[model samples]
Target: MSHHDNKPPKVCIVCGMPLKDKNDYPGGDTSLDWCKYCGTKDGIHPYKKLLEGMAKFLQQTQGMSEEESKKAAKQMVDSSPAVKMGKVKVAE
Candidate 1:
């Protein structure tokens, strides 16, 4: 088998979330590179879509203001593996 077959679960490149279960993957597709929130059956969502989702998650979970959540989300997105590796692009 390929070495990749034994690799451990990957953290979501877009949101830094751990993909530790089948439910964590898009359509339960463990073969996908990103997590469920970052994609769907159609494949990875757009950068803006990911940013909004992360920002909303931050706001709801951390009780941060909308601006604060958005700022944090932007930072996470800019430094994310997908962004750094050029798998995903940021518009600005």
Candidate 2:
């Protein structure tokens, strides 16, 4: 189970963006399962594939180095609401 379950449902499970943050989509509901970037009709992310993208995003947005982002990205993404809710799974 994901460790983010106890936290508020404020982060996008797909992109790992804080739903209440300034980056939220204007005129769109933040209550959705994901943010504007990663949030899609599927309401999920291909966990294994998404990890790489997320690492870069974290590098740019959070100011983490690429190496650091790559190392830490899994904890951030795996703790999202989608994973907590069983919306997606790690690829075998």
Candidate 3:
């Protein structure tokens, strides 16, 4: 079965944006195309971006040349709920 078959249909966890078509999320999962108003709400988008970036940095850098630093960063990133909320941008 496809990945989508296992998980429930995608919806914005915060704003209930329907993830059903290209207009909703042109780039698919990574698009993170929530309702326009929700995506632009004060202190939401930027914070989300920051958290997402941190998580990505941690995940990618983990167990690399600087193991300790990587681990520490990963720990910090994983500890924050916000960092875990955003969908990761998958490479195309």
Which numbered prediction scores highest in TM-score against the true structure?
1
Cα error, candidate 3, residue 84 (Å): 9.0
- Residues 8-82 of candidate 1: C-alpha lDDT, one tens digit per residue: 768887887888777899888878778998888676788899889999999999999999999999899989989
Pairs that collide, model 2: none
Each prediction's total of clashing residue pairs, residues at least 3 apart in sequence or on different chains, is 0, 0, 0
Backbone clashes in model 1, listed as residue pairs: none
Instruction: Give a tens-digit lDDT track for model 2, residues 1-92.
Output: 44656777576666656776535743375446677666454455477656787788888889998889977878766776677777867554
Please, what is the whole-model Cα lDDT of each candidate in the order they appear? 0.86, 0.67, 0.45
**TM-score against native, each model:** 0.86, 0.60, 0.28
Q: Is candidate 1 or candidate 2 better by TM-score?
A: 1
- Off-target runs (Cα >4 Å) in candidate 2 are 1-10, 14-31
Q: Candidates 2 and 3: which is better by TM-score?
A: 2
Residue 7 lDDT, candidate 1, scale 0-100: 73
Q: After TM-score superposition, what is the CA distance of residue 69 in candidate 2 from its true location, in Å?
A: 0.7
Candidate 1, after superposition: displacement of residue 31 in Å?
0.6
* Distance from true location, Cα of 86 in model 1, Å: 1.2
* Candidate 3 to truth, TM: 0.28
